[model samples]
Target: MTASTAFGQAAATGTAPAFDAARALALAQETFDIEAAAVLGLKARTGAAFARAVEAMLAVTGRVVVMGMGKSGHIGRKVAATLASTGTAAMFVHPAEASHGDLGMIKPADLVLAISNGGESDEITAILPVLKRLGAPLVAMTGNAQSTLARHADIVLDSGVAKEACPLNLAPTASTTAQLALGDALAVALLDARGFRTEDFARSHPGGALGRKLLTHLRDVMRAGGAVPRVGADTPFTELMREMSAKGLGASAVVDGEGRVLGIFTDGDLRRLVEKGRDLRGLTAREVMHPNPRGVIRDDVLAVEAAELMEKHRINSVLVIDDQGRLCGAVSSNDLMRAKVI
Candidate 1:
């Protein structure tokens, strides 16, 4: 059968032709190459206009209102989110929705990032006058600089692509890629200008893995009070074993009379004791323990830091001490893993 006939039959019967793996791979690579070239082209275009956009956004007292339609609108939402997460206050406002009532969200002190590849989205252009009336500065990201949206824009960012990756050049493939990359460039520039740090990013993303790693403290995951496997320095070796077993921490802290940790007795220590054939029946915890064991103070140490400390020392657990050098708690690598901060 002819290729067109096969395609038609497949469309009608909901069955595709035998997949050509090589053709599929070639097309995918071509698409990637096209999009990559489009992004590379943007590097040279990053002149005064890009700098002006960043400055405008940085100077704004209010949020950035991102406006677009269809595929551009989808990209706008992501851009707004990136800006918001990276220290710039931003929100996506669909141009169509703005025409009805959402335009109220934009204020005079705010800046508007209008996206339209053709520079002629009716929904976006329809509200340019209203935005002007509100005194909101317009920053246009468009392909056609002479188009209506670009002509009226306070700052024009050229986001034109050589061509779409789509075979027919009908879809918003390369154009959308360029727009997205430009949006990211704006966000990263704003991020650097504001000196946005990982801690600040963690604050904005407390529910994610990065947040958990950076925000969660050692104290938050450490076992304290009765849960911590602690024993007196003079505690019998058998009693130390009981403490370790009872807490299920695989280790026990040998503390002094004042509740200050003096040493640590781990499963490895126990193994060494067995290998040495030491008579544990009458031994004290201090005799078999590793003195001045590695530990951290319960201050502002992050869980990820604690995990790193444990890994560096080749230990599974560490005693958590307070400013006064008293044993406050204990944390294990397992705790960090469980908290998803490792």
Candidate 2:
């Protein structure tokens, strides 16, 4: 058959010849190259406007109010969420909504972050007077410095790009990416200026697992009083089994004469000891203990860090220690997962 006939037959049958992997890869690479070039073009052009925009946001005693339309609105929501979760109190308000009585949400002490790539969004530009009358500082993110929004804004963050990655070059692909990244850059810059800390982030995200791990205290979760499964060093193997079953922590802390932690004897240790076939009835905790178990402090240790220590040592639990190395509490792999730290 002729090559053209074979090609036509394959196309008609919907079972074309082997795909061109090299051509497909080249197309993917070209997209990233063009977009990267666009991002690279955003260099020192980020000048005093960037710094003033951040200062205006920092001076906001109430909240950072984000306004945008269309794709810029979607990107603004993400930026608002990131800023709120980090340190800066912020929220996204659609410009369309602002024009419709939702303008009451904006306070005089608030700072307005307006996003419009073209700097001529009718919906966004239309609301400038409303926000201006409210006495809030306006920070505009725009591609056109000469546009009305940029010219009227108290400060303008230039988000212009050299070209779009779209094949037709009419879509808002590269410009939107640059705008999103620039918005994040602004949020994080303010976060640093505000001296935001991990503890502050935890407070904002308390419902999340990371927040629980970082904020919950060790004393709150550790098994204490009668709940702790403990065995004295002189206890016999028969008594130790009862302790293990009673406590249900998979192991027992072996304490010494002063009720201080000496070592640990776990289920696996019991199995190993039993295999030796010595005298189970007479075996003491001290005799069976595997010495030098890893321990942590009680005061300020993060639950996630405790989980890391457990995984690193390939152990199920660790003894919580104090400045004097006394056992103040205990933690297990179960505690870590329950705290959502692991």
Candidate 3:
């Protein structure tokens, strides 16, 4: 058979020759190249309209209502999530669902972001008149500048891609990648405009490790009251060892009569004493303990900061004190590891 005849047969049958490893790798590389080039082109498209879209979203007192169809809808969902997590109020509304009854989700104060590659999605364009009547500003992301959605939009963001990574140009590939990138850009720009900080992100993601690092305070994870291993400065060395062993904190705080922290003694100190063959019979806490040991205020610092302080001082534990310099609790590196702040 002729090469053209074989190609026609394959296309008609919706099948192609089996791909070997080298061909598969080459195709994957080509796909990445197409998508990367498409993303690079977006840098020049970020102009006045992009800035206007950000301003419009920021100006709205209500949430951003994102609408799209099919693959664009999937990207819109992610965009909405990113915006909401980054301190912007946003939610995705399916165009078909909006036509049914979800249009109620859009308020007069809300801003609408509609995505359609061709700028002619019937489901999305059909609602433009309604959005206009509701006094909601419309921002359209599309490749076609003169399409219906673009023409009716208050702000037009050109997300045009030169080609699709799909060999047949039938599937949404590079176009969707461009849309996703533009959505991320919008979310990040709004994040910067609002001066969103890491703590703000942590607040939004309290279940994650970063949130634990930022929001967990020393008081929350410290051993307090009776659980803290502490002894008076005049306590005998045998009593101090018993307290340290019972508490299992690997260290004991040596404080004065009023419970003000004076120093600390750890297993390392015991090792040094043993190596010197010092007599424990007459030793006191004041003689064996480290003077003016490092400590942190119980409620004044985060657990992560306490961990950093431990690392800085090369110590395994720290005494927690109150504002008036009274010893209140103690925290160890184990506590930080358990809290997932280490």
Q: Highest TM-score among the candidates is held by which one?
A: 1
Please write out the lDDT profile of model 1 over residues 1-342, one tens digit for every residue: 533334456667777668867656666877899999999999988899999999999999999999889999999999999999999999999999888999888899999999999989999889999988999899999999999999999999999999888755678999999999999999999999999999999999999999998899888898988999989988888888999999998999898899988898999999988999978899999899999887555645887887888888888888898888898888888888898987
* Clashing residue pairs, backbone N/CA/C < 3 A, model 2: none
Determine which window of 10 residues in candidate 2 has minimal summed lDDT.
1-10
Would you give me the overall lDDT of model 3?
0.90
Among all windows of 10 consecutive residues in model 3, the one with the lowest summed lDDT is: 1-10
Q: Would you list the C-alpha lDDT of every candidate in the order shown?
A: 0.89, 0.81, 0.90
Model 3 TM-score (2 dp): 0.91
Could you tell me the TM-score of candidate 1? Answer: 0.92
How would the candidate models be sorted by TM-score, starting from the highest? 1, 3, 2
RMSD of each: 3.4, 5.4, 3.3
TM-score, every prediction: 0.92, 0.86, 0.91
Candidate numbers, best lDDT first, in rank order: 3, 1, 2
lDDT of model 1, residue 42: 95
Model 3 CA RMSD to the hidden true structure, in angstroms: 3.3
Per-residue lDDT for 1-342 in model 2, tens only? 533344456667888479767645664666688777666666657878888888888888999888888888998999999989878889999998888988899999999888888999998888888888899999988889999899889998889887776545667878888888888888789889989998998898888877887787766667676777778888987898899899888888888766578888898898887798877777788888877777544535666777777878888887776666666677788876776666
Model 1 — which ten-residue stretch has the worst lDDT? 1-10
